[model samples]
Target: MVPIFVIAGIAIGMAAFVLLIQMAVRNGIRMSGLIDWRTQYELERIDDADGGKPTLHELYEIAAKTDSAPDAIERNVRAKALDYIESRNSIHVRNCWIVIGVAVGVCFLAMIITLASSPM
Candidate 1:
């Protein structure tokens, strides 16, 4: 039983570590402003061309209604940005929860192992 708990704890810890790394990389990309460049460029382009400010999603909707080649390209870029933001945010939330859960599991396992081996 003790060995099993030890193994489980190790596995959970490794998983938490991987999640931490992924979160770090995701945040790094976001914080470094790499993800915003394309979105910003697109918004600026739309602002210059139309002079009517629209949110990214709004721009995507507008582009969808248009038949112009430029609008098609804009729609694709906006879609990609929206998708990236959504996915990255979900990953961040999931990583936080998993890491917290793993920490709690490790603590519980430690307590159980200690109680099992200690003199009662």
Candidate 2:
């Protein structure tokens, strides 16, 4: 029979791993500034005095400040911001899932190895 302590250890390890993943996602998004830009604001348009590529923060600032919510420029900025955040989040989720899949596969393989090697 499988040991109760082994089962408990696996359960605790999985729970801890899930909690770590959750905390990583929360901290990663916040650290990347995606969390800050998630808002409905009435700021002001950011002038590109240098006429160069504005940062995402600047675009967000200009995007939310417009009086007309759906104007071409504002809509474009909004779309860009949404796409940026979504893409970043997608990447993080993909990575986490891949790691989980790999870990599960390794554990499964280890179990098979042990079961096959054991005497009948």
| Top model number, TM-score | 1
| lDDT top scorer | 1
Task: Tell me the whole-model lDDT of each prediction, alpha carbons only.
Answer: 0.65, 0.56
TM-score between candidate 2 and the true structure: 0.47
Compared with the true structure, model 1 gives a TM-score of 0.48
RMSD of each: 9.8, 9.3
Give lDDT tens digits, candidate 2, residues 20-89: 5884766475446544453411111122133344566677578667645657766778677566556555
Tell me the tens digit of each residue's lDDT in model 1 across 1-120.
666777777777777777777777855665466757466444344534455455666656666666468757676756666664555556666767778777777868776786787677
Candidate 2: count of backbone clashes, pairs at least 3 residues apart or interchain: 0
